[model samples]
Target: MNIILGASGQVGSNIVKELISHNLPVRAVIRSRNPGFDSQVEIRTADLFNPEQLTDALEGGNTVFLLTPEDPASNDIIGETQQIINNYKQAIHANGIKRVVGLSCIGAHVEANTGNVLMSRMLEQGFADLDIEKIFIRPSYYFSNWLGFLETVEQYGVLPTFFPEDLEVDMNSPIDVATFIAKVIAHKSRSSDVFELVGPQKYSSRQVAETFSKLLDKHVELQPVPKEKWNETLASAGFTASTTANLVDMTQAVIDDIVVPENPDAVCLPTTLYQYLKEKLEK
Candidate 1:
C-alpha cells in the first residue's frame, strides 16, 4: 500500500485523488482524515513523536510521503528536526519503504541564507540519513495562501501582498504540484530524485494584483505592511506575530528578488494565479 503524510492538506488531498485516479491503494497518516477521500484508503491516527507508533504506521506500505508541518516556537530547530528524522530514518531502515517523496521547500538544499532557509537546511540533514530511494519536491510558495483574503480584496479593493510587490514570487497551485508527486509516488523508479515545482512565471505583488484584477474584474490594490503590522493584522485574525513575521519576511524577500529556483528541472506547471483566483472567488 502507498502511504501519504499530511493527507488532509491541499497537496495531500490532491495527491490522494490522483493516486486513486491511477487505481492505487493508499494509506494516509493524518491527524484528521478529510471526508473527500475514498473509503478504500486506510486512515491511521497516531502520535508522530512516538517512535513505535511512527514505525507501525509505515508498516505494509511501500511508499510514504513525508510532509512535516512547521512549529515556529521550537527552540532548537536542529534538535526538533533530529527527532522527526529519527522516526523516518528508523522506518526507512526497518520497513525498507522503497520510495519516499518528501514535500519540502525550494531552497531546501541551496547554499544561501534566507527566511525559510533553516527548515530547508534541516530537511536536507534529515533526508541525508535515509537509506531508501527518495524524491524531494521543493515547491515554490503556495498560491492558496492568498485565497485567505479574497473577500477582503474583493470588498475593500485592498490585499496584504505577502511578499514585496517588486519581488518575483515562484508560485504554484497546490493541485498541480500534488499531481506530479502522486505520479512519482505511484510508479516506482530505480533513480532517486529532487525536483523543484514552480509556477509558469515569477510574479511580483503588482503582477499578482494585476492577475486578480483581470480575473475578478475589479481593481485590486497591493498594500504592503511591516512585519510587526502584518503580525498585528494576523493576530487579530488568530495567528502569532513571530509566525506572521516569518511570512512577512519571506514576502519581503520576494520583493527584494532574493528567492530563486536552484534546480534547473524545476517545472513550470499548468496553474495560473488568475485561474486559482477565478475558481476560488467564484465559489
Candidate 2:
C-alpha cells in the first residue's frame, strides 16, 4: 500500500488523485477528516508529532510520501519540525515501510543556515541511515506561492515581491511536482535517488507581473518590497517574530543566488507560467 502524508494539501491531494486514477491501493493520512478524496481511498487521521498515531497510519504501507508542513505561528518551528521528523522515522521503522519519497527544496543540499530550507536538509539527514529505498524530490520555488497576491493584483494592479524586478529565479507548478512524485511512487526504483524539478524556465518578478497583466487584462506592475521593510510586511501578514526572521533569511539567500538546483540537468516540467496562470484564471 502507498501512504500519503499531508493528503489534504495541494501537492498531496493531487498525488492522491493521480495514484487513484491508476487504481493503486492508497491510504491517505490527514490531520482531520476530509470528504474530498475518492471513496476508494482509505482515510487515516494522525498527528505528525504523535508517534503512536503516525505508526498506526503507516501500518502495512510499503511506500510512503512524506513532507513537513511549515507553521509560521510556532515559537520554535525548527524544534517542532525535528520532533515530527523523529516521529516519522520511528513510525517507518516500526511499520517496516520499504520506501520514502521526501518532499524537499532545491537548496536542501546546503548543510547549514539557509533558513526554511534547513528543514529539508534536516529531513534528508534524519533519514539517511534508514535501510530503505529513499527518493527525494527537490522542487524549485512554487508558482502557487504567487496565488496569495492575486487579490492585490486584481484590486490595485500591483504584484508585491521580495526579489528585484529583474532577477530570474527557478519556479515550478505544484501540479507538475505532484505528477512527478506520483510517477516516482508508482515505479519504485532500486537505488536511492534525488530528482530536481523545475519549470520550463526561470522567471523574474517583472515577467511574473507581465504574465498576470496579460491574464488579468490589466496593467499590473511589479512592486519590489525593500529589504528594510520585509519585517514590517511579514509582521502585518501575521508571521511571528522567528518565522519572519526565517523567511527574511530565505529571501536573502534567494537574492544572493545561494538557493539553487544542484543538478544542472534538472527535469523541467511542461507547464509554462502563462499556461499555469491561464488555467488557474479559467478555473
Q: 157-190 in candidate 2: lDDT tens per residue?
A: 9999999999999999999999999999999678
227 in model 1: Cα distance from truth in Å? 4.7
Predicted structure 1: lDDT:
0.75
Report the backbone clash tally of model 1. 4
* Model 1 Cα lDDT, one tens digit per residue, 185-276: 87778777888889988777788778788887888888987655766776677545555455555555555556667757788888888887
Q: Give me the candidate number with maximum TM-score.
A: 2
lDDT of 2: 0.92
**Model 1 alpha-carbon drift over 4 Å, by segment:** 71-82, 227-231, 234-237
Predicted structure with the largest lDDT when compared to the true one: 2
